[model samples]
Target chain A: MIGEMILRNVFHRPVRTAISVIAVGVEVMLVILVVGLTSGLLHETAKRVEGVGADLMLQPPSASVFMAFSGAPMPIKIREKLEEMKYVRAVAPVLLQFNASGGLDIVYGIEQETFKAVSGGFVFHEGGELSAPNDILVDDWYAKAKQVKVGQTLRMLDNDFHVAGIVEHGKGARLFVPIQTLQELSGARDKASVFFIKLTRPEHTAAVADELRKVFPRYEIRPLKDFLSLMTSSNLPGLETFINSMIALAVSIGFLVIFLSMYTIIIERTREIGVLKSLGASKGFIVRALLSETAVICGIGIVLGIGMTFGMRAVLTRVFPTLTILVTVDWVLRATLIAVVGGLVGASYPAWLASRKDPIEALSYE
Target chain B: MQNAATILAPAIEGFLPGEWDVDLILKTDNLWKVYRSGKLEVSALRGVNFEVLPGEFVAVMGPSGCGKSSLLYVIGGLAQATRGHVLVDGNDMMALSDAARTKLRRHKVGFVFQRFNLLPTLDAYGNIAIAQHIHGNGFDPHRFEVVTSMLKLTDRLHHKPSELSGGEQQRVAIARAIINEPKILLADEPTGNLDTKNSEIVLGMLRQLNRDLGQTIVMITHNPEAAAYAGRVVHMRDGVIVDGVPED
Candidate 1:
């Protein structure tokens, strides 16, 4: 019966209820989408890195696990030394340059045979591998994104290169060129950013990484199998704080909306509160009824927000195919918890006011 | 007749030690209710002594602002008296905490207002059933059927207040007041908004509730015809009862 009254009161003022619900929905959507975008990109990027068929990645001294952020400080001869290591089967030296022409992307400069040895070669969709000094290989997603064709000239890093081939995605980077060609183009003549080492067997990755770490303790030696686990917002600098700030902002939106809605309800229903008190309702009962009403509103908002999240995800991913927005179960639960708690807290003061209203005065309230 | 336990429990728990008065259902001693705004003092009730015996239906009649409503509120524990003692079912309302007073109101007192005071959002059944719910008493189907049937509202239980006539809304309010079996029913002009016929019908029901069920009642009103429904009338003038409760 109390539940029925709550529902009635919720719908009694439709416009206010809708505005509050939409506000809460927007808060939940914001929290979910903000957390989803960053985590999805990081996880997807890590998966693509692990998909490169390398068992171990060796970077320059004090280099970041994110090889894109690390410069080409290591000499290209480090690949030869890594190739001669115990249990090392193949090594590919890659020079990376950050490209910002159309969008943010890492350009990989690689030697054809050694890159093929480490990555099991690309599945070309249009043309073959890089052969000329100005030739470049683009992946299917990147080709579709930038509208690149097989024989068209693509200008990047202030250098025009022939579009040699279009390969399947999920290799390390979208755009691939010869290492020595990119080395000259970027003014780092004998430099490579990182080495991708393919071990002789799967189980020898830990031992090989440990041995390499001892030889060069300052260098970053990361096993590819553990890359996905390390790709979290907390592992990256300032990213977790950014996500928390967004969540706090979302919570504030939910709080203020719920506060105003419940306060308005209290004022609008002042006479009704008197009736409730005259009916012998305790303060706890009144508080519970108001809070329960807020919970129902928040519940509807959360469902709508989650639906909007998936709807927006579909629209966004379709329009931007290369962009990945993942809505995980963990983030969805966290958003729900956050919205509900925020809404309850926002309604507390109003509930207290309602419970404390003088019965005679409230009955006499116009 | 009330159940044996209902009759016996109040005897045991409804009084401070050695202060029990079994003959009186409600009583007030020098009830003074003063409403002060800054330095301007307005006395709503001043040294007014009133009493109601068990199973008595008493009416408090006065013009507007004469403190009849203030007396009702004071006795029902709905407001604190500036200086007075209100005893309901042998329990002093002045000394109890807010929670205790609320509990007393829940179990021992019920109220009906001039405007019906029915929650507009709820239907007749919900309005009636809510009283038991608020009193923390479990639903009693037999009592519900009996009361709704007595009011001739068994079929109209699903109608909202807007759908019901003025008399029907008042009947629903009356049903809500009695469903919890409160020790006393306090009403402030239960028929003020009704037409002549509806007022007659509602007053008839209140008399029926008092005569047939032996329910104690204290009704506040200005109309002499409305006060005539009660077995006795107590007239108030200028915050004091000019003519007190009549001899049974």
Candidate 2:
């Protein structure tokens, strides 16, 4: 009955109801979009790092320090030294650098045969495998941003290289090059920037890191998961702060809009409220009726907002290609919980006003 | 002999005492209602003593600002009197908790507003059914038919308040009021919003409800013609009862 009454009243004032619904929907959509973009960035960055299947990365102490803000150089020989250990299954050497566009990029020096093992069987758009020493594989994002195609030669760090293939991975920007070619181009003798180590299994990875810290006291042996988290969080604090602030702002707006809408509705229907009151409706009943109206309005807005999120995903992707806005089940759950809380918060003020209305005063109001 | 006594009792005596006797359904002693706005305190009801009996139709008549509606609101438990005591169905309103007073108002007293305060969202039947529902009682559909038919609303059960005429809406309000079988029915100018035709229709139904169903009704009205329909009339001025004609 409360639902029916709310539905009827909602339609009775179509213009006001629509405005209120749109206001709520816009706020909800903003929150969903911001959260989706932020989490997508984090997930994509992690995916790119996970693509290598390296249990841990060994970098020069200062190399780990500047890895987030800017690329730093480590000796090219760290990979060879780590590979000699019996516990180390394989060591994929990598050199870190940045393009002229200021986008940080990884230059991996992967063995022709062993590159397949470290690539985690990732699909390449053009090339079947990493074969030529001077050929480079670039991610679609980097390739598109640079406007480079297969067989296009580009000079980096005084060495010219050919774009052999285009690679696509979840949300990560990467460019792969052969080990000898990266080593020769960078002009670093017997020195590798970073060592990507694949341990025997999950259990041996932690032990290997512990063992590496003891053996090579000068380098930082960071597990893939922890390293990426620290790097991303440290690198993107501004975006994270902005998203957090936006969430609070959106929720506040949702509460205010919903509350005012319900308040106006209750005030306009004073006679109806009195009738309900005089009909033996407890204060609890009155409060529930008003809140149910709020929930219904907000629920409709949220459903529309969710639909809008999906419909606009393509546009969002086009706007920021690096962002992987994957609408996972968890995100949907979070949005639902946030929306429900927002609806409840919005209804609280109006419910109080409704419960406090004197049936006589209300009956007399209109 | 019994039929003769029963007929004579109501015509001459104030009321017959029975299990459903209306006498003392509501009692107020020296009730006062003072409104304080900033520094000025105006008295709306100044020590008015009143009693409404069961199975009696009483109209409270007074000019504007004569405290007629204030007295009704006080007696109906909708407002708290500034001073003095109000007792409804043996419950002292001043002493009862807010929740208890709310319950007393809910289960015991029925209210009809001058505006025909029917829920606009509900149809006539829906409005009537809500009373029982709010009181946590299962709706007795049979009683719905009896009350609605008594008010001449049998044909307009499904019509919302906006769709119905003022008279029909007032009738639905009355049906909703009496659906719970409340001990007292308080109508504040139930015909105030109706035209002569609709007013007559509503007043006629209220009179019939009192005479046939033995329901107690207390109406606040300023119109002499509307007040004349009641079996007894009470006049108020400055929040005190100026005159009251006994039922005899």
RMSD of each: 3.0, 5.9
Which run of 10 residues does model 2 chain A get worst, by summed lDDT? A62-71
CA-lDDT, candidates in order = 0.89, 0.75
Error of 2 at B66 (Å): 0.9
**Model 2 clash pairs?**
A75-A191, A75-A192, A76-A191, A76-A192, A77-A191, A77-A192, A109-A179, B22-B53, B22-B54, B23-B54
lDDT of 2 by residue, A1-366 (tens): 455666877777788878777767777777887777777767676777766777888887745433433345566666667887757787766655544433545566656555455546557776545667767777777676667788888676556777788887532237667767666666664556667787778678778888898889977778876755664434563776897798888787777888787878778877677667666677888888777777777778888878888878878677656557767777676766777788788788778888888877777784
> Can you list each candidate's DockQ?
0.77, 0.52
Docking class of 1: medium
Chain B TM per candidate, please?
Answer: 0.93, 0.89
Score chain A of each prediction against the true chain A by TM-score and list the results: 0.96, 0.75
Q: Stretches of candidate 1 above 4 Å error?
A: B1-18, B246-248
